[model samples]
Target chain A: MSHMQWQGYLRKDGRKGIRNYITVVYLVECAHHVAREITSRFKEHPVQLIGFAGCYPNAYADRVMNSLCTHPNVGAVLLISLGCESFDRKKLEENIRQSGRPVNSIVIQEAGGTRKAINDGVRWVDWCSGIIGNTMMVPMTVNDLVVGTVCGGSDATSGITANPAVGLAFNKLVANKGIAIFEETGEMIGLEEVMSSRAVNPQLAIELKKSVEKAARYYSAMGHGSFAPGNADGGLTTIEEKSMGAYCKSGDCQISGLIKPGDRPVQPGLYLMDVVPDGEPKFGFPNINDTVEIVEMISSGCHIILFTTGRGSVVGSAISPVIKICANPQTYRRMEEDMDINAGGILTGETTLRDTGEKIFEGILAVASGIPTCSEGLGHQEFMLSYKTFTPLGPGCLPV
Target chain B: MDKLIKIHSLDNVMIVTADIQAGEHLHIRRTEYYFDKPVGIGHKVAAQFIESGGKIIKYGVPIGSATEDIQMGGHVHLHNMKSDYIPTYTYEKQYPGDANPSLTNQSINQVL
Candidate 1:
């Protein structure tokens, strides 16, 4: 048996972070350049840039941004405000400070323009990085880890290899008392029955079913299904077909609860993140792209994300590391450096499902223990946040 | 050891594990059929004859229904198979069937 443990940064809020990063957040699109400049100036430092682009106020955006800024992985925050946007910079800074992380805000207009704001932001980041470098590290067990799985650019091999392998790893994590999450309700369209059947209780089953229905309705209102053209080229005949492959990432564990984006899991078990926005379909799509969903998973406090791809998606989130598991042997050969594991070995009969699954599980531990993922090493920190609306989860959503 | 993989025993389609050229003979479960068109890797090929509007079973679950009769060894994709839950978006505007009213209850009942 393989025995492994990780040392993570312990936050004052009692949460453990696998990475200590100084996050520079842009409150609006106008402040993006300044925030980017601040983080870019300290290229050698472990700093990440995240932000919202909309000028209009959104409760969902506010909640997600707050969760991200105060994420355990983030040791400090530098919020760049355009001074006129509706993103509540004061509330964001206050929340970060309350989480016991060093936080500072620079308003571009108030600081006498772009040059002054950028200069001020750079100084704040430098100071924050110094403080983060001195943060204490504590020994963390597997139970302290919260891992999330997402499948992007999927093909037939995904269902046969990587997705099921992820499911196996998820099962192992859940068995070890670690939190496991699988999101993309829009992608889980036809697997509602299979998914609901794995719920811990009948009420959660209903909620699971309703969540998928909401996704179907939401996509229908947008005049398109969530199925992309690349999915078709990848041999996924329908959204349901793609969903069956995507559903395998959840493994065979009973789902403990349901949560919308930004809602943290209260217990160590499997949870389904309802990515579809609540109420009418005002936003174009629940998740505009794969990175948006990744952002939501990060907001939910995932220490690391297991990203499976068949058509090859090379992406990493700002706040969390992404472990890429390539499902297609051909894709793996083409992008070996970008993938962390080659699950396609199962299709080639060179390895069994259990072997690949264990590899993915081990890969997770390695990443949490301070190993940089292929995406991280390649500098693929892709961040995106959009406007949306969501109603708070009902009491029944989490029975435990 | 075949290039096509049957994900579930009950699935009526098999996914091509590698690119197959036209006229290539595929052997599955002691049965052999010749491919009439090039099938790319990750694409689906019919395991048995499927009638028009019949459900296409993959992973032992219904992914969609056949728009036309598909012979054994025929390619199964958007050109022939379509979603039963929601209208599948295709480049060309074609069938616009009403959403299946029984989808919700039927899917739940089947799994339960």
Candidate 2:
């Protein structure tokens, strides 16, 4: 038996959470500042601010909110409504109530505007913080966790070291009966056939291919692939090269299913998140930035995200923690404080890839046991969600 | 110990583990080699003669194809290779270097 042991906040919905966060949600862009103010004063607590800035209603936004508010990691949520927006706070409150979480709503217009709203929201947070501390802690194992992996700011070294190490860790996670998800189909353009070959079924293989093909078409019509100027500077020549590097993070595990953003996995195994928006190029770049991708993973119930970077990234999610794995030795040295694992040690031959993978697997357990990740310690709860379109997956999307 | 690695036996390039200066001497696959042009760490150096339009293999897969003939030990980058997939994007503006040029300091790395 494994020596590692930890307890998790067992939710009424039967899911376990590594972190219990109190989130202040803004229903529209108008209430964003007030929500921020309410969360700001409660800095000592794990209170995060999240919201949709759209005044206009969106089915996608509604789905994202329903999943995020009741995310296993979230213990309580306070909705801030501007009172004039189309977002249905009552529906959201009902969703939270059904999930068996304490939820409250504050309307800026009805709560005497910004000053009074912030004051009222703060009081509720203060009151709820006391009661939420009593959440039952249950013994949990790796099987109770859902982890996601994504790579960003990649350089040539990424594929050779950190990403492959992550792949090894993902394989370990799957072996231990944990759920592992890898995303960024936009970056997997050149490896569709090879990627889909690992799918458990022919139907899922076809869906994987279609998702990558969709990403290729979306970026092609957008006038550029997801490759960036920094990639060029980091010795990555083209999108295919970057894709090859990014693909290493998925490891060699069999893909159990394909899913769009805001969709949850039904079983414990490896999954692929098709983050690219469906249909013709419509809502701008599929993801305007990295936080959008992080938000999507968090909404899909990822308890923690494995983030690999060669150039180094500093951001974490609002509810879940982000573990940064640095791919380059020089980049790791340059940004030591920000990195959680120095997979770059593989580049200098100081450590083997499997050793780094072992370190990362331990790191995940450590963070899940309430040890603060570097991002969480630095207070990097970055969150961003934007407009995008994704038609539901076909019936054959998930494997039997 | 060698200052670079070929990653795979079939790879046509070596990944430099240490920054190589123009006058530096190194050993690749136990053969003595000299660097005539500098290459930064994590950058690629041709492991063998690569003809124009020939694929550059790494991790036993084709990352890209050479745009021009590259001699053994030559630096391989955007100047000499192109992706087999879609065209990569680039900003038209020239920016200064060395202070972190990717995303803002407070922002997460945004690459896909």
Candidate 3:
């Protein structure tokens, strides 16, 4: 019952990715510059620089870093370590190797100095790049891909048009056995019940409801609500109203599980990513901005993010492809060059929601098949890492 | 003849979709209104008279509250409307008075 189709890179772990890339991950803030330098040394290489600047340890951060290091798109990893930090680099390398990908780590403190680290990193990356194309390519299909969606700077038109249109694509993806994920409980406050009713089971429905409620309570105590200021200018009055509009981006997929940041979906179905932290809010808000959400989704194994916006955002992630789905007709007309899909046509009477949804669906396949998005071509390689903590999901959270 | 402007079907209030000068005919969701004054974009006017402290409902939600009674088709905005939540102030009125009670030392101590 689905028209969506895809061709992706078959990875060693059996997961299919829309991109096949070699990632250079810096383990600490001190080594980031050198790591970036090494990646830049290979100008034409399909290499991306992603890292965390925090030296302090966080279980949540560790998990996210590990997931990204082993994501399916990655053929190899070159880790730059400061050696003194408690990042558990050895364990992370082991995890990546376990996924059957080529991985190497160079501790800056142990590898002589900055110049030496860069030299060693470049050598390792060169070696990995040599073997990247050697990996046998297997046939990949839409059922093997996993995708996520998030909307930022939403206006009134976003809810009525693009958000629901994304939901349509989400439903199509899920029906075809591809894993679909949606997040930002801060934006899902008022629609918790409506969202829960679409879950695959009663248990997941309960977890879905509890997660958004938790986010609402957390943001309420912070004084500034999760409702963004731009939302008000665009005709949204309150958090609940904004939430109702924001929730439409998920479409009508039956949520199969509730996941936390960096937690991979166990099977190919719809999942609600619980982005809010558990226990007392300690390490600031769960996500500082839009890029943080993109990073979280990528860290959870998404190959690309279907980012919908009404007010416009120009950010693109360092690791995965981002398809900017413009929602507002006026904003789209103004920023057409930056957008990947113009869902605003729905409002112009030029196209139906289904037509816009199909366009986004086809855009996803094209990007997966090696066609670059506007952000990817413009070199908008932005990265952000923030601190947060969470309790591991209990038995009730993930059910088979 | 005119097209009806509607805020929400469940709402008692409806906004003028277009500019309406005084004495102009207005129809909203089948209800007619003869405006007593002009109304601009994002401004609200009642199809009938509304009382003070009444809820300014839109989309079946409370947007804010009216501060004074006004006739049908009269302009509704900041002058005659106020938020239901605690009043917020800008830098101009930093001092405590009946105009701003939440900033008083009494309230501060109570909060502490």
Best by TM-score: 2
For lDDT, candidate 1 versus 2, the one ahead is: 1
Q: List the residue pairs that clash in candidate 2.
A: none
Residues A1-400, candidate 3: write the lDDT tens digits.
2334445666777787667678888888999989999999986878989898888888888999888888887878889998988888999999999988888989898899899999999998888888888776656666777789998886666765677778778878878788888998877765665577878888777788788767866676565545555654444544444565566667665778888889888688888888888988887777888899998888888888999998888778877899999977789889888889887776665676678888887887778777899999888778777788888875556655
As a TM-score, model 3 comes out at 0.78
What are the root-mean-square deviations of the candidates from the true structure over C-alphas? 6.1, 8.1, 7.5
Model 2 CA deviation exceeding 4 Å by range: A1-3, A225-239, B6-14, B20-40, B43-57, B60-112
TM-score of each: 0.83, 0.84, 0.78
Ranked by TM-score from best down, the candidates are 2, 1, 3
Spell out the clash pairs found in candidate 3.
A167-A251, B4-B27, B4-B28, B5-B28
Write the residue-wise lDDT of candidate 1 on A1-400 in tens digits: 3356768899998999999989898988999998898889988889889899999999999999999988889999888999999988888888888899998889999999999998998888877766777888988888999999998887768887899889889989999999999987777876777678888988988898888877767766777646677878878877678888888788877899999889999699999999888888787777878999999998998989999999999998898999999998889999999999999987786776788889999998999989999999998889999988889896678755
Candidate 3, superposed: residue stretches over 4 Å from native: A1-7, A226-239, B1-112
Q: CA lDDT of A328 in candidate 2?
A: 86
- lDDT by residue (tens digit), candidate 3, B1-112: 2322333345545533334666777554565667666664334565567789887664445556678996666666657765443212222246656475433312122357
DockQ of each: 0.32, 0.24, 0.07
Off by over 4 Å in 1: A226-240, B1-16, B19-112
Write the residue-wise lDDT of candidate 1 on B44-110 in tens digits. 9899999999999986678889999999889999999887763222212333673443332233223
